[model samples]
Structure formats: structure tokens, C-alpha cells
Target: MKAATFFDGIGWREGVVELVDGGARLRDEVPATGIPRLDGVVVGGFTDHHVHLQLVDHSQLACSRLGRVVDLGGDPDVVQRLAVHPVRIEFAGAFLAAPGGYPSDRAWAPDGSVREIADADAAAAAVTEMAEAGASCIKVTSNSVAGPVFTDELLRTVVELAADRGLLVVAHAEGAGESERVIRLGAARLAHAPFTERLDDDQIARQSASASWISTLAIHDDPARAVAIDNVRRFHTAGGTVLYGTDLGNGPMPVDLSPREIAALREAGLDDAALLRALSPVDPLDPDSNLLLLPGSSPAAADPLAARPLTPADLKV
Candidate 1:
């Protein structure tokens, strides 16, 4: 066991922890005697909620600050191979889209990364394929501007089938009304903050009640960025859960943590505590949690985004 100052969300407290092969686990109160002590601040594992394994230099992630990453789109085999790379991983196998929906024709999207389900009848086989491929969630697309979007029936079918399999549906909603439809259809998460249009308070309220939005705000420019930020601000204020995501493969952002993404989230009014929550999908205080140790960090939640978790070499028991 090791002892250090730990952050319990609202403030810091002296704590004891056991660093494990996977990550650190919390034990009990701090300032305990007769135990080895690690100097630094301890927090739960950080997860980048949205990423594309086929698009990013994922090799760099082994030494990056993150402890967990969720691949929102990729070839199933590619994503599964990445899961063994030290950091904990969850993935949505491929982008479920209409026959010709977005990313299907994009040069950057490798073949087999987009699963086009033209009819609701194909939904079960699609979900089963991903689930069997070790997928933790299902990604559906509704980008009417790019191509044929999902019919309401198709989206509902996917959502229901995914739910039955105990998976959450993460939707890439880019066109007008697409996000609204995704939210009402019981999708558990939005792949990106809505950037196409500003959401009314009522819509924001409705969204906050059912789904969490991943903040990929830095990927947008101008009107889109501002619109996304505004939507996030209102949604958060309305009690929405915001997950810190970089959309890692979409741009030239850092492979590990993106300061720009953190800045955008700050602009959206997430203070240090909220930022910590965004970084972590599970409570850091739990004994089963994967933890991050930022050496010499005080309890004030200061400069946390700058931390690089212990690399695979350092974390190897």
C-alpha cells in the first residue's frame, strides 16, 4: 500500500492507496503510518470518451496521460488489438450508418470502419457483430447533410437491440434535428456536442435528462465551435453530464491530452471539479478505480490536465 494526498472531488484529503498492475486502487483515509508513501496527488483513471483507433497514432497513447480511452469508431479487429495496449479500452466497433451515410466515402475512413444498415431488419446482426467483437457500445450515425441518414425506425431498432445487449448507443448526430431524434430515441450518449444548431432551453433540458455529451468542441471552428460551446454551457448548466473527449483522430491534436479541449471545456463553465469528473467515468475514490498519480500535485485541482499518468513501463507491477 502507498499513501498520498487524494482528491475526493470537492477537496483534497490525505489517503492510502494500493497501486496495482492495471491501476491504483483506493484503500482508506490518508496520513496512515507504517506504509510506503508516494509523493504526489492521486486521482481516478482518465478516459478520453471519444476516439478513432483507425485515425490516431494510438501507439503514443501507451505513454500518454490517459488510463482509459473509448474508440467511437474503428475496424473491430483494429480496436480489439488496441485494447491490449496497457490503457483500459472500450469501443464502438464501427460507425453504424445508412447505406451511404457519412464517413463511408471519406478517404480517411478505412474500409470496414462504417457498417451501413439500410433496414431495421439488419440491426440485430449489426449489433451482434460488434458485441461479439468486444465492443462496449454501439455507434450510430445520423448526418443527413453528408448522406442518407437513418430512418427513425432503423435508429429505434438499433437502440432497442443495443439496449437488450446491455450496450449504450452513442450517436454521431450532425444534421439539424438529428440530435433531437437521437436523444428522444434513448441513445445514452452523444458522440459530439451538437454544433449544427443552437439548442433551445427545452431541448437542452430534455437532452440533460437522458444523455451525456462528449466534448469534442475544439474540432470545430468559428460558428460551429461557438455553437457547440454554447450548447454545452447551457446543457451543463441544466445538469447535463459532460465527458471530456478530444475526437482524437479528427484533427492534429495531441495523442494524449488536449489542452485546447480542456480550455474549451473551461470556457463552457466546467470548473476544476467538473473537469475532473469529465476526465473520469468512474469515481476515483473507489477501490476498483484505475488511478493517476501527479507528483507534487496539491489538492486544489491545479494543472491537472498537464499530468501524464505513469506509462506502461511505470505501471507494470
Candidate 2:
């Protein structure tokens, strides 16, 4: 089928994409299937890097434009079951926190979703349980504002254990000193961009060099929102990897691609190319499985997020 125009995450071009078994490839020529001409640009499907499947209606998410999602924290058994759904999912089985830590007492957390480590000695075992349960990464909490947090030693142990298993560690770091601890402990990613406080330049550079920050910028409001936007902007300027992740299911937010979240990322200083890269999946995540065909000419290069997402079935010749 011919797409009048298309943007393959790099630039705009006109081409006929041959869809094969849920994947697509650009071709020079092909026999017309008598399918009506497609107008507008086609691009890769997007991924929401942070979400809680246990809290949202999974069916609604499956029907949305999102091609894949990374479940940050959820009940292991429930997450495992949902992983088999049509919308691809990469998940961290549960939230590993210090005993009585954040989310343990929260009304939203499901049973068996938050495992509190009793001591540093149990760090390895706890991480192993998550990996064995098919978790893509280990998620740990370092939210000092909520309650008790993992000591440096315990946090270090958890990171090491995850590393040993060839998995990365994503941390929910909030409150004072939490970001510093996450950096010092060598976590590979921050579940949310640093909020609650403005980070100094050196701290921002250090964190940027060490870990990628998921842009949950739309989740914050007003003063705190400005702080996060500044931190992310500096981090991006310092050559940090900014990933697009809306904390879906955490509050009243869109189950699919959030235009507000995209706008926030742009406000955080990400250009069109950077925004595309953030939304595109990396190796093993499979962004090619589905295509986002946007009607009309490509959206302003700087605001590609304004385009809607369309599935392969919607564009199949």
C-alpha cells in the first residue's frame, strides 16, 4: 500500500511500505492491491516507558495507539498474566523497598506488589525473586518523603544483584538526598525525572551520565513542575538520555499516548529528533511491530507528538 508520505523517525519521505507479518519495509515498487491510497505520514509506534498495568483497564490500553509499555511496579502474578496481552509489555515484577517503605501503606498498591527487604543480606534474594518471576528490570523505592528508605549498602546490594542477573535497576527516588543516593548506588534508570527539588548542575550532570530519567513531567504541577522541567532540560543539554514515560494509572491520565506529556517533554527542551528517539523503542522492544500513520502532512517537526497513532491493520494494503 502507498502511504502518500511518511516519517521514519528521522525525516519525511514518500514511499510504499510493504507490511509483512506485523512488520514493514519500504519498497520501490509493488503491484497495487486496489487498496485506496493512504493520505498523510506513517511512522513507528510509540512506547510509554512507565505504567502500572494493575491499576488501569488493560483492555483500554490494548485498543489505544501505544505499541508497547514498560510496567514499572505491579503485582507479579497479575503483571505476568497481563504481559501476554496484545499490546507488548516489558515489566518490573514489583516494587522492592525497605521494610515499611513507600507504597506499602498506600491504598493503590496491590497485595504482593511491594516486597520490603528486611535487611541488606536479603537484597540478593529479593532481586532474584523478581528476575525469576520474568521481570525485565528490578524496581526499587528510595522515596524518603514517604517513609523508611534503603540504606546505601542495601541499595548497592540490590543494584549489584540486578547487574549480576543482566538486568538494570530503576528507582523511584523522591525527597531530599534520594537522587544522590540513586546515583551513588549506580541505578541504571530513574522511574521519574527528579522532582521535589531542583538539582545543582554538577548533580544533574552526574545523574545524566549515570542513568536515564523517564520524563513523567506532566505528573507534577506548578512549582514542582517547573523544577522537573528545568532538571530535565539541563540533563538533556548535558547529553542525557530522556525517555518518554507517562505515569499512567497513577492518577487521572490518558491510558494511551498523552499529548500533555509530549508537550511537557518539548517544554523540557527536546527537539523533534530527540522526541522521536524518546518515543521510539530500542533493541528488543520492537517498535516496528506496529506503525503510527498520522493523517495529513507531518505535524510541525518540533511538535510531532501532535500526530495521532494508527495501527498496521488500519494501514494494511
Point to the candidate with the largest lDDT.
Answer: 1
10 residues in a row with least lDDT, candidate 2: 281-290
* lDDT scores in order: 0.82, 0.79
TM-score of decoy 2 = 0.87
Q: Model 1: runs farther than 4 Å from truth? A: 8-13, 17-26, 33-39, 281-291, 310-317
Q: In model 1, what lDDT does residue 139 have?
A: 96
User: Across residues 86-193, which tens digit of lDDT does each residue of candidate 2 receive?
Assistant: 468889988998899998989999888998897766787778888888889999999999999988888888888899999999999999978878878889999999
131: Cα error in model 1, Å: 0.9
**Tens-digit per-residue lDDT, 1-317, candidate 1:** 66667666555677666656655567657555676666567776578999887787778876777778999888897778764345788899988989988879899887788888978677888999999998999999888889898878778889999988999999999988989998888888999999999999999999999999999999999999999999999999999999999998886989877889989999999877788878773456765555677776665655666564533343233
Query: Pairing residues by index, what is the TM-score of model 1?
Result: 0.89
Candidate 1 RMSD to the correct structure: 3.5
